[model samples]
Target: MSTAIFRFYEELNDFIAPERRRCEFTCVLARAATAKHMIEALGVPHTEVELVLVNGESVGFERVLDDGDRVAVYPKFESLDVSPLLRVREHPLRVTRFVADAHLGGLARLLRMAGFDTLYDNHFADDEIERLAGVERRIVLTRDRELLKRRTITHGCYVRALKPPQQLREVVDRLDLAGSAQPFTRCLTCNAPLRAIAKADVVERLPPAVREQHTRFSTCDVCRRVYWEGSHWLRMRALLETLGC
Candidate 1:
């Protein structure tokens, strides 16, 4: 058996057991193993790892483990630039589109409300989410660590927050999306961009009071749902304000 000491940094430690978190721990490799497999075996998905160092030298996931080697792993650096070093993924996702798993319905709605291009269906299977994320280049947001471990999923995140509201804050802060928030610009239900429409065109669909009181309106291009600056809109704005977005 070969042994190596592993240290996970920052949020990467969240995946480890309480005893192993925030410190170096020895991993006994039964046989020859790649860094990727060994790291996943320790509960940290390779997707969440931005950098891996073997004995102070930058190495890729395919690096072969050796006895007495020291390994260090790090989470994605949102602010700090590690351009001079090697990153596990080919490139960072510049456009912040997202695909939420079945369990993240409320978080998906919140993302759409913030005007992000979020694709979500409660019936989406794990494989389907992986395929969509890989083919469409959408970042997968899920609570399942194993889902992020799929080799096909190049971009994904493990949502640490439990509540939908807290999850929204977590995602926003993690993605640095506060400046990009365009509230009321997307369909909360359909994930389609909202377009300004003439109040006269959608008047028949609106309630009598809404038609009489609200002149400005927007409609979802896909769902055709009408929206106006009503009480709900005001309440949503208040929510956004509370979120600092």
Candidate 2:
């Protein structure tokens, strides 16, 4: 058996046992266990971990443990650059496309409203989500810890907030999405790009008030739904602005 001192930083502690949270604790490891094995054994998903440090030295998850090792596990760094030390993965997801599980439909719609390409279906199975992550390179966003622990899921986020609005902010803040966000540019219901449609083409379909009050309009090609600058759009714009998108 190997014994080591372990400390989890930031949101990583959410997955660990309550007693071990925000505190350094001793742990026993099996023979020849690597950091990846040890961490997952402790209940923290490997995908949630961004960096691991042993004895003040940055190490990858594959680093084998020693009897006297000291391990510090941290979630993704928000501001401080640890690019030189990142071993779990070298770079962040360049394209932040996401595939949310069954329960996160509200968050998925918010993401779509913020111009993110999001796929959501109440019937999406865990296996399908895992496959999409590997085949399409889409980030898996869900509150399920076990789902994020899958070996095939290399990119993912464990959403913490329960409310849709809070969840949206948490995801945006954690992923640094403000600069990349293209609010109101995508169809929230159909998850397709919104194109500027000629008002004449959709004029007959518009309600009397919409036709009288609004000249700016867009439509979803997939759903053939007309959009206008209305109260709902203003509310969404406000929400995105608060998110710094």
**Candidate 1, residue 16: how far the Cα is off, in Å:** 1.1
- Report the number of clashing residue pairs per model: 0, 0
> Considering only N, C-alpha and C atoms within 3 Å, which residue pairs clash in candidate 1?
none
Candidate 1 residues 1-245, lDDT tens each?
78999999999988989999999999897588989999999999888899999999989988999999999999978889888998888787878899999999999998899889999999999999998998889999999999999988888889999998899999888877899899999999899899999988998999999978989999998888999999988987887888788
lDDT of 2 at 114: 91
Q: Worst lDDT window (10 residues) for model 2?
A: 83-92
List TM-score per model, in order: 0.94, 0.96
Q: After superposition, how far is residue 174 of candidate 1 from its true place, in Å?
A: 1.0
Residue runs of model 1 more than 4 Å from their true location after superposition: none
